[model samples]
Target: TNNLAKTACINIVTLNSVAFYIFIMSASLPSSMRKLVVKTLTSNFRKAVEIQTVPLPNPASGHVLVKNHFVGINASDVNFSAGKYDPSKQPPFDAGFEAIGEVVAVGDGVSQSFIGKSVAHLSNGAFSEFQAVAGKSILEIPSMQPQYIPCLVSGMTAKLALQESGNLKPNEKVLVTAASGGTGQFAVQLAKLAGCHVIGTCSSDKKVNFLKSIGCDHAINISTENLGQVLKEHYPHGVDVVYESVGGETYETCVNRLAVKGRLIVIGYISGYQQPMGVATTTSARGAAALPVKMLMKSSSVTGFFLFHYANQWKSAFQELSDLYVAGKLTCMVDDGSSERKGGFRGIDDVTDAVDYLYSRKSVGKIVVNLASSGSKL
Candidate 1:
């Protein structure tokens, strides 16, 4: 049998005349060298990022030093780079949020047994070769492949948004807009798993087929079909739960299609992320009455959901998602599309290109960038 584990090699890289070593092996336990991905002060999603070798720090007490094997790319990564997440935030900062890695070293008070365990993490510095994550943030997994990284963010977010935010119930009618996206794909499957009849919206026929393959009950090509008409004619009673992300007109449509006592969970508004940031006006300004009034009339509710804010329950959510995957109830579809400049984003250097491809809004599933991994053959 072929062992999928690949060996990691140490590389000496120079940044501004200073040379630093990346990925120090146990034999060379200096613990003073590391590598990180950074962006300049004026850099945005439209600009390129830099990979620089820096002084690596030993794991702090109760923390584990992990050698990252794979990192998950999210739309939030683009928003963070574009200065939309925090306008006051300056550059020369590390990017990325979720990753899967193996514990190469442990800090004071941590067990040495963690050294070889593969785990998933949601830490601050994931877009690099290594991350010293606090022990509590790690979720032990069976594989270190880049594909599993999406389960940390997109998967957990989808599970929580439906179960916690939407209060999903079996046999209910559920609707997910942007249903072919990272989180949306998971939402579609999870809703189906819960015995809900799912209606997903996508922009293209390819994505429509992708959603259908994943067990989505009804896939609507919003680019070609009239969404409002489809809902009115086919689902006159409206849907029970709406997992909404794309805002603006799509949000309005979802709101209008809410069944009595229905719940609408707002995850993000990707429609406005690329545009100039500004204060948002109420629905009444568009000649439509207040959305709250409409919700009140139907005895429905609208709530917002942000996964990071519910950090305490992340592990529990991941546990359920992992079980589902292990039991063959959940599947992750990864989009391997390339940008105009690169054939495929197989290395860290192609992150910017990957982000650009995501913004093009053409991918059908989770978009991931594979990191070169070096480990003992299993």
Candidate 2:
């Protein structure tokens, strides 16, 4: 009888302690938070979106509340705002995509221990001070550093697209368009790591140098040298794999240069993102109809890769990328935004400028906006 009473007392004490912890965590968070919302669907992000203060989101069952520290800016932000990604969805919706932060609170069915853990997530409405996300959806990263932000989207895209879509093989010739850009850099490094001779395309000598430093065997400054001429003269046999992101002319160039049975993975078409939504599609469709003949001649094929479609592979891809990064075998290059704008991109207010910077074609690597003033140690 005495033991049973003592046990009941201990359980009551534990329950009270957990309740106190939950109350404290909830109380510490502000009643209101600022977030960017898309009021209109337009290519002009700054004009379409507005910052608004709203009540802090409570973590729903099986969810966790996170305080975002950094958010990654992608070239596709314009497409998102323009409603290219999803035409069916109507606005006044949340803005932004991927963010890294620390979990501050957990809801029912979530362990209290998860609170204060560093996590990263790829979801809508990431351009906010705080977000409530599903516990399972959040990936616990090594730290909240901006470098890891690229790995969540760009790195995974490169790694998975190459392995699954490109069918990359060892000792093969690989070409990566926009090699100095976010996903392009990873494609270059991953191709090199897979024992392929990597050829990267850039717009300037600076980008060429950056590509070379990241193990690109050949960095072609397309602004100066003709991409087709250089590939034809040096790599007459053609490349076995092409990670073609830049569309239009670059896409045509890649199709013409594919080796026998080669694969070209089309992850994006940034060249056309600035154009009217359907304008690029019309041009691409016309060109694509003729690609069958070119591909048939070389016995090659073209495949489209969208990251969200391969959700099951994300965790494994991110884990491998994180391991490589920790081992110093991978470099997560993040553009500081100083080259384009003074003082660089910092805080939520600078997210729109960061998006513009990405479109300017001046950024060398991943563009990330710093959200937190200080970071928690790994």
Candidate 3:
């Protein structure tokens, strides 16, 4: 009897709840508000977003409207916030490299098949509720490639910069600096897949364990010990290739230990980014006492990489990186936080906290900004 009574109580409560919801929803909601709620909510749809009502520009032929699902925040975004990067363009603009959104509308020549498709794409003006899309910058991710979204957007260049410049071959030995950084982990994993013996360098002993967990055969602590001696002990013949993400004294140390004909791929200037207030500012090839390259006598080549400049070729990089990722050979580590909210930015002001974090070097790997939680405003 008691069991029957409990079931009856549950049915009553569920019915009342449904009835209340029906009453609330039956009221005619404004078109603006109805447009706001797109997804079929589950478990109390919890998300905070900055909404903007823009004049709906008709998608030109070959264009589709993208209603963003997830936006990626990268170091470049932080740099852009701080006014640190070069080649400035006109302002009063949207600043973002990539966003994943579903198509809400499409222009002529666009197929109806794209109506509900999830897309991963590069674009400016992505840190918002909606964005106008240009079809050329977008690509539909097939179901099989769903999991590769984070890596393909955040760490894609990290992979290509190494593969293209490292000239990695099967069974060659490779070492990566800042191995636990966003790009570093992927570089190490990619090298290992190429059958290379992988060594990783990190600032902390704790990071070394994470490195080793993901295909790094060895890890050196760059913060405390002598790097050259450590490398000599582990890589007796020296390492064949290096993905140089953090440059500085580390670069000098790494350059000294390169095997003859080794290749050094330069992907970032993280080492020079922050110097204390009183320290001498570095200029001209990033400062240090001059070293005679002739003395090392190695045929190693150093190549620089800048992803945005390769904008025309982003998908090629994404496709290859995605393939390796789906094969279970790569990992992307995200240091996600609420920079977007804590910074209280609207429009351009949104970038401040993220910029501060990057300059502070307060986090590791790809620092992701959680826009939903931060209380910051523009």
Candidate 4:
């Protein structure tokens, strides 16, 4: 009888404690600082992107606070959400890298000029409505348009991969896999600008048309046409430069199709991003072989590219791309499905759908998500 009475008292005390904690938490959250927080990590990326209200953080010394206007959806974002990109990033880790916004506040040791300036940056925690970023990394932009967000990563990557790493020569036969993708589209245009004969591969006729419109000399629909056959017949002499992102069969074919002294740039392998990490398996279809023998026999080279590794080149590269844009030589193709809706995929609610569209292999260009409802037109 005494033990039963003690148990009842303990249960009541526990319930009171829980209620008090909930009340305290509720009272602490300010209405203005609401943000999303990833509550859990799941195999389904959409389910993994959970929405929670978090307190907006203030910038620290050497950092600026940004009110996010737009954010970009890269293939890596999906992989990050799925826990396949970085093992250290377990549940509750914030995802997203590229974003455009206006500086609302500056921290100690930061210049006051940063306030009220429009900027773009590549950083973690971009999935939220507000972020504190190192002021030195911010790039001043003309507006909050999502179009400029790609220039933060994708454009710079494409330029450096071809002009610096690949060393593409005029009239060189260049092939780009996933040509209609965010980074791939930039590669197609940049290769053409370098006077290289650019060929791009996609899965749909819609993307094929988009590629051609962007100066691609040839577009191969991998879904309807055989990538190997097309390369064998048209590029019998082998390709001089290959900007490969899609892995698996596409990667194997690119290795086999390299010309003597050819250069193949490895940007990513989106085809395997959703599969098991760092393990050889069936569903992944991530395979390639004869690399050492093939490279030695042909004097060809393969270079792996990670954009952040070339941080020093960002300023100059952005200047060059911006100049091209002003001169009408560079184009920024952002897919937000705005045509289907008045301002499609605006707000955090549509991020899941935006990511789904990217992996669907249907989008022909960069997939951008607008955080500000008013900035959703692009």
Candidate 5:
């Protein structure tokens, strides 16, 4: 009976030690984290933001805490910081849009199963070490690869904008402006996959080569050749669908070149992103009065596409893009800041430079900032 009691005591002590160790491990997360916030409203993204260290946020009910590994930089980031996207938005707001990470904790009523899952989300404050996002917003990916970051915003925009808004049909003649850009690359490839004859416009010979490599039937180097002249001579009937992103005169050119019954999907007006909000708005409104008559003559229509407005279709669109990527039907190009700049964009400190590189039009594809260091793999 004495021996039995001793054994019982030893077992009790072992169990207690294990439980204590588990508690310590779970509580090992740091008390604070760093994040970028827009302290001022400016077109110059570098000057508009500041880094701040604050207490790590706990997930609220129906939310999950994610430790970000990579974040995506978009052209609209400048518009966001400048308050062009939302004029009512004030300063000191979070700066980024999309990130890929591993969920470390679940909030009240959330399934603990979400913890440790590799997920991606498109939400504000993505350029941070950690973010607490709604549990339902998380996209469970195959793994935590930087490649998946582009798929969230860039890929989804191209897929949905083309199919849903552009009304893309097989064998249709499709034109993509800024064709070698982040979302442009996806638009070019997706149009090709749908059996459409694709035309892409770029500024440099290098970008022209890239467009051709991606199966673009016509890679127009706008620096030397005229986009208007090329389309007029080769595609006299005009294009069936146009993915127009570059605004200003480019927007006018696309509108004038549309075929009868053609559809133009306006995803962004990057040409005016650096201008003052009023100037950009005025530039966009320049031809609005004549637009109705123009469309009526050709039976063509212009549609605007904003990803945030189509939240319900995001999940299914992401799934289709993921499948295409896995099956090698789709290619995700991520510019990690090596070719355009020194050292490459790694961590929150480099996010501003990455944004500049994107606006420089030197990047060939999606610009991503690595938040997780070599030793920090979660």
Candidate 6:
């Protein structure tokens, strides 16, 4: 606990120990002051949020203030919001990752070029009105930027995943699982731009057409048709690169389909973060494919990617992608959501509705949220 909070808690316990002392303390405060003190005390997060003032935070050098315009609600935000992840950090920390904001207040020892330009970064806690982040963490938005914010996130992430893991070459077949999801949709489009024959896997026939519209040369409905058999029909020889986004039984199958000397990029494992069904299960499909022993013999590579780590470490590479986005060689998808609800809807609220749309496996684009902006429609 914070020292101030600990001291306040201790004061409460001590106040109760002496009933007579409470009366003495009550005498010390005027009636107006007592009321003011009582009013400042909060009962919940909503109460704590009821405010107008932004505290004057003392930022060290290399930090700049960003007046934010957009923030993206990631699946990781959902996991963090639902309290499903381990070590459960206390509530009241801001939740969000990718946001587009303009530089406003810069701390000492930084460049003047930073002010007035828009930027995107990897750190969470972005679901707020303003932020102060390290200079290196923020990247200036490209020339051909979209009017909306989430596109910056999708474009950056898609380029990063493909370049880092697969190093995809022209016309090499790439298999993207969870092909219609927020991130997977980007993978499909980028793989095609790189001159790869992209095959995407979705949950239904409805999304299959959607995937094909976005540069997927072939699509698979994993719920009905078998992924292994479908790949056998399309590539025949074997898949050149496997972009493993959905993990579980699907992970096993993706690993199995890798061609000899093919690469498997372990991009994401959404299955690992999901709530359990009260039982354990197993799968065996993927038979004798992409074995660890065989991978070593063939000199094949398997790389694990986490965007949070890479954006901080590889700043130059991230900038190159920003340039690609402006070149129009890359395309991204967006689902702005329906306006059926209240005053500007966003975040986990939209996700709860979008999850059903996603579970139905019909959504064919990157999921986005438009946070409350009065007078604007969702």
Winning candidate number (TM-score): 2
Q: Name the regions of candidate 2 deviating beyond 4 angstroms.
A: 1-24, 281-287, 341-343, 373-378
Model 6: per-residue lDDT, tens digit, 1-378?
A: 699999999888865655445344334422210000011222221232222224534336988766555565455544454444423455445555666677665678877556667787656656555667888788777531333344445555666778877889998989988887777877888888788999998887878878977778989888899888887777777788888877767777666667877888876666654443232222443434436775776566677876655654445655665555567654555654553445333532343344344443445565555433423333
Model 4 clash tally, residue pairs: 0
TM-score, model 6 to reference: 0.70
- Candidate 3 lDDT tens digits, 103-218: 66668887745665777777766665556687777877654232444565556776667656777888887888878876777788778877888888887777877887887898
Arrange candidates by TM-score, highest first: which order? 2, 5, 4, 1, 3, 6
Ranking the candidates on lDDT from highest down gives 5, 2, 4, 1, 3, 6
Please report, in order, the local distance difference test score of every candidate based on alpha carbons. Answer: 0.78, 0.89, 0.62, 0.81, 0.89, 0.61
Model 3: CA > 4 A from native: 1-58, 81-88, 142-149, 274-292, 338-365, 370-378
Candidate 5: deviation at residue 84, Å?
1.5
Instruction: Give the distance in Å from residue 206's predicted Cα in candidate 6 to where it truly belongs.
Output: 4.8
Q: What local lDDT does model 2 show for residue 16?
A: 92
Tens-place lDDT per residue, model 1, 80-152, is 6666767787777777888887888778888766777899999776887778899877899988755676688
Per-prediction TM-score: 0.85, 0.91, 0.71, 0.85, 0.90, 0.70
Better-scoring candidate (lDDT), 5 or 6: 5
Q: What is candidate 5's CA lDDT for residue 299? A: 99
Report the error of model 3 at residue 40, Å: 40
**In angstroms, how far off is 179's CA in candidate 1?**
0.9
Give the range where candidate 4 is weakest over 10 consecutive residues by summed lDDT: 280-289
Best by lDDT: 5
Q: Which lDDT value does model 4 have at 284?
A: 31
Model 4: per-residue Cα lDDT over 1-378, one tens digit each: 999999999989977876675455435434454444555655456777777676677789999988888888888776677676566766777768888998877789987656778998888888778889999888888766677877778898999878778988899999999998899989999999889999999999999999999999999999999999999999998999999998777888898899999999999888877665665422333333457888999999999988878888887887787678767888888998675457777887777778888888877688888787633433
lDDT of 2 by residue, 123-207 (tens): 8999999999989899998776888998988999999999888777789999999999999999999999988899999999889
Q: What TM-score would candidate 2 get against the native? A: 0.91
Candidate 1 lDDT score relative to the true structure: 0.78
